[model samples]
Target: MPSTPSLNDLRQQQQLAFLAQKTELRIGHAHACPLPPEHLAELDEHASEVTAVLESGLTARVFQLKLAGADYALKKARPNCLVQNLDGQTSFLNELQRRAEIDALRQRHGGFSGIVPTLYGSLAQGIILSPWLSGGTLQDWDERKLIQLFASGAELCRHGLFEWDFCPGNLIDDGRQLWLFDFGYMYRFDPLTQFNSAGQGNDVPEHHLAERIETRAYFAWLLEQEQTRGQDSALAAFRLEKEIAIEAYRKLRLELGADGANGDVLGWLDGLGQQWRQALRGDGEALYWQEGWRSHRLDLDDDIRGQTCTPRTLARCDWMLNALQGNFDALRSSGALAHETIRPERGALLDHYRRLRSQAEDFQIA
Candidate 1:
């Protein structure tokens, strides 16, 4: 018998249909749109309305638009996505689909406080619009910011939407709240049965909400903290984050269990919570080092794989090389390299990272 098509496969079909113009794709608050479908279809023709243009995004060109006494973000999908991966290619369509899901989730659960509200989206027009969030990206991670982020993440996880990317560009802090505006890398999964949206869901146990945040966003910032402040400062930050994550995961596990989640899922959450709690009680420096190593290694590999490396990627490569050279024994003892198919000797590992660092420099996107 033929295997059933996955949700990803179905979404791809929907994307193709929209691209082919065989199906109309429109969602979100149409009444809140700054312009009609016709105007949005040819938004470039009305350049006078554009206040600013941000072309740095990998999948879309964003325009800050002012019209009828209001400001809005108009995200127009690029003809070709800069990130050379299948996920990047379909990101625009995936974003639209996730937005629709999020809209429904909001209606059912009142609202997701930290997620940005989509004003309008049209797949055929290759555009998405949301209110212009007036705030800068995060420069510091205080207790409040960490709490808000983890709360938002837990909420998304409960609703079965696994957000893959939490990079700086996708987040905004509007004084009052941290807003997650990007959905391009977010995917669907069974919160009651899976770790994340990757593969068979439970198969990739290493990929979870905290891991995604740490790997994609937190560790990069922590690297700067380590360089400027000291190892102690970075370790302190990691401990704080893990404490918040522990509570968040505990609450999440109870919620999922109450909603009839299976034993396996509950057990996984319990394991994570217990591990962190133990580490916190007994000087979490080793745990911090291990997770930092894993996070940087995974994120560096992701950048190289997507061919979207930046200077930050080179920095992460340097961190990994330094770790391999200076702390190879500790890294091995911590079981951080246990996941590798073949454990590389220290020399081989250094050579491997040096090559990756060169590749990162070559593929700098900005």
Candidate 2:
């Protein structure tokens, strides 16, 4: 009988598998991209003239390169991922895989209008180049921006690609369009019978497109508004987004149903539509409070675990403490703080948040 592999041996085997798979990715270039052969050959010669270093973390080094009288974004993968985990280690390879699939899909389907155009890439060399996005990250979520985002997400979902991250950094609004340039966290899911790209179709109802944006992006934005504007301003913004989400979901459901969607998927969408419709009629405020708490806490835990804490993390903690102080009973009744072990008194909860905030201050991401 063969001996069982140790944990270290298994890890090594996984690493080898990852490397082999990454090596198999085919290099693809857009026909319209302007870079010539000489520019590709002289990447090293002009390396010192990098216009900007977008990111210098454990995953990859992103540089804004100006060559051939044109600007481009170059991403070079690092040998060791900064994330220090399995997913982190394989993120670059995962991105390459998604890019290849998406690029192919763009050729067959109408096209991914919201995705950044890739120029050239080599998976073996761990490098990808794309046209430089001449836009800034979204500062505020307006109606137009929300529509573009939701439409892009819905389009990807219809094609069986589920994006899991909507963080501020991964998205850019080029005035006329919102562009998604990262695919490290996007995964495949069955559109006909699944709710998202995780587990079974109905296993995780909370992981939908709207929920993802709410949990990962909007809640933090709301926290910031609660300070600069006020609680009423934040709540108003949440309500507006929810209204937009409701319409987006309705359209998605109609399209999926017409496309011979599975009964399970249809039923799931129906349930979501009904819930949002009812919430909009009367229970919207309650829903906002419940989802607001959930989004903040979930996002906070993610940042803390990844050691990428930001000012928003501290702001979220502050919001939590304030909610506990003024509306503890309502929050508790709504199951927002259902998992707490400590007493729900103001002092205890305040201490807890303060400790978390202090720890987060030490781990701010660069």
Candidate 3:
């Protein structure tokens, strides 16, 4: 059997791949809607105009630049990815590759209207430019937004692209449209056969559309509701999302089926379709509880792994602890706690969670 690549080896491989592609990485300012010359010159000079930084993070710095009576977003990559991992270090290049693919598909397929158009990019110079999305991050995910997101995600899936990161910061909504601007973590997958871009694909069926939304975005929204609006409101929101998901999946199945996709892929879709149909009609409450525990646990682990814990991370921890306190039996029965080996008493589990929350509190990213 082939040995699995170590983390260091993977990082080295990414670095080498980036170096190989570096020569072709010069900024190709968009031909259709080019950046103003003045702004380009200012960026070249690294002037005070560049100081209007909209966001600063481990991997990139995003700035809002106004020129020629229009606003543009300038994202400059860091020398080393602060994410301290292979995927993080190569994300800039990955984004460029995805944008190129998406741009080509948008021209040929005419179904990818939801993606934000990249105006310019430079892999060598570590810069990208796009029209500043004149919108806010998704706050309340109504049916329209959910449908739009899932439809776009499904389109990408059909085209062999799988987007892993569906975090709120990566999504934007104008009054008329929803946009996914970040493609850093969007990787290729086999739409005809495989599940996603991870681990031989079909091995992990749980990482599907609804799971991604729930794991990355919806759970946080639900957490907010559990705190402010209460459990009933949170449950309602989950049901609404699931209903939208069912509709979206049905549409995707039709699209892929018409295209003569592989049987395994079709079977996966049919399974989810059946599961959601049954859940919607029969035990939505149980389904909600199971998915809630999963979303909270997975998302919490992700935050902790990235060492980017926020107040929200602690809130998820709180939810987990509370669930363990009152609904531990139900949670275990639902297989939400399958990873846990020792089925401790409520007191012991509660203490364990308290320790986790305390650890998370200390790791909160500013």
Candidate 4:
């Protein structure tokens, strides 16, 4: 039998492939990069350009280069992704398709911070060229900016782009616009349509095209399902938190376009704050993480049982609930929730957040 190549062997092979490239790469960018010249002949000529390394995650070397008055981002596959039929062909096709989907977004030109990358094409050198988007990610943004960041993130999810790794890292802001970068794990799909049809497609929809990313119920099902039984508690908890934030985020997005919803992120969070009301509806213990959840709260001493909330806090919670309800009603109403900016309510929303903190403390004691 042929000896199975070890991981070390694969790494060695990959290094060899990387070294074979003649272009002198520029260093200290995002990751190790060799910007593809627009013409292969040009790359052949200036094979001695300064070396550049990108502080990014291209799975392969990606470099930024300006050729013929236009900027382009280039990525080359490592040896591991180029073996025989295992990871080679499939990963290549996946990335090509992913790039194609991203390029398709050029037609919409939506004002999303994480706007999809513009994929130019791939080459024989195992390089893929995309439009360079220079920007900071969500991790680099502040709280106020985060709301817009979340809005843009939701914008992608709402648009049917299932770039599930749509976190701050993959998102960039080069001052003018925010752009979503690195799409290896992202796929496209229509959740309602896919779930309704039993999900048998070769290609997933882009993140910008999905009707909904996820919600509170999404977590409920996952936590209750046996398939995810062995999943780590931290991961599961994070997923739950993400779902809650996503739910509120979706509502905030619609508010950008003059929808009736208040776009109260905190209000949407209220549903997440109290799982009791939801768990009360069915087999209570099935999905409720009462213990893990209690431990996850802000404090343990505060108790909110039967205590009337301060007017501001109560109003905030009510607004959030209303925002969620409004979004659902809108989605089910006209077959889609219109895309718009997410304008949040300020003072009341702040009060609501504080109250949630208080209630969260109460939640811990429960």
Identify the leading candidate in terms of lDDT.
Answer: 1
**C-alpha TM-scores of all predictions:** 0.94, 0.85, 0.89, 0.42
- All candidates in order of lDDT, best leading: 1, 3, 2, 4
**What lDDT would candidate 1 get against the real structure?**
0.86
Candidate 4 lDDT over 1-366, as tens digits, reads 986564334534554464467333321223323343344223422344313436344245565666555655656555454223323323443455566665556456645544555444453445565666665444333333434445655555444455434434456667655565666444454332331111242222211211222221122223334234544543444344444454544474444333332323234334343553454455443233332222212111111332322332233344334434444343223322222122233344345446565674443310
Task: Put down candidate 1 lDDT per residue, 1-366, tens digits, no spaces.
Answer: 987665567666767666677476788766778788568657773489988887768999888889898988999999999999878888988899899999999998876899999888988788899899988766667788878888898999999999999988888888889888899999989998888888668877899989998998999999999999998899889999999999999999989999889999999999989989988997787788789888998998899899999988988989998899899988888777776544457887788778879988888886
Higher TM-score: candidate 1 or 2?
1
300, model 2: CA deviation in Å? Answer: 1.3
Better model by TM-score: candidate 1 vs candidate 3: 1
lDDT of 3 by residue, 1-366 (tens): 997764335545866676776566544454634455334534633554553674535567777776667787777776676565667767887788889888888879787888988777877557788889888777878878888899889889889888878888888899778888888878877777787777667767778878888898988898888889988888888888988888888888888888888888889888998887787787477787789988887887777777778888888888899898888888777667766545656777688778878878877865
Which sections of candidate 3 miss by over 4 Å? 3-16, 26-52, 56-58, 339-352
lDDT of 2 at 86: 62
Query: What lDDT is obtained when candidate 2 is compared to the true structure?
Result: 0.76
| lDDT tens per residue, model 2, 1-366 | 986554334534665597876555645754543555335434552476478876634467777877678888877777777664566766787787788888889989766899886777766767778888988777788888888888888888888888877888788898999998888777777787788866544576778898888887888888888889998888788878888888888898888888888888888878887877787788466777788888877777777777777787888878887887888777777667665677756688779878888878887866
Name model 2 segments beyond 4 Å from true: 1-16, 20-22, 30-49, 56-58, 338-359
Q: Give all candidates' CA lDDT scores.
A: 0.86, 0.76, 0.78, 0.41
Q: Model 2: which ten-residue window has the lowest total lDDT?
A: 37-46
Whole-model alpha-carbon lDDT for candidate 3: 0.78
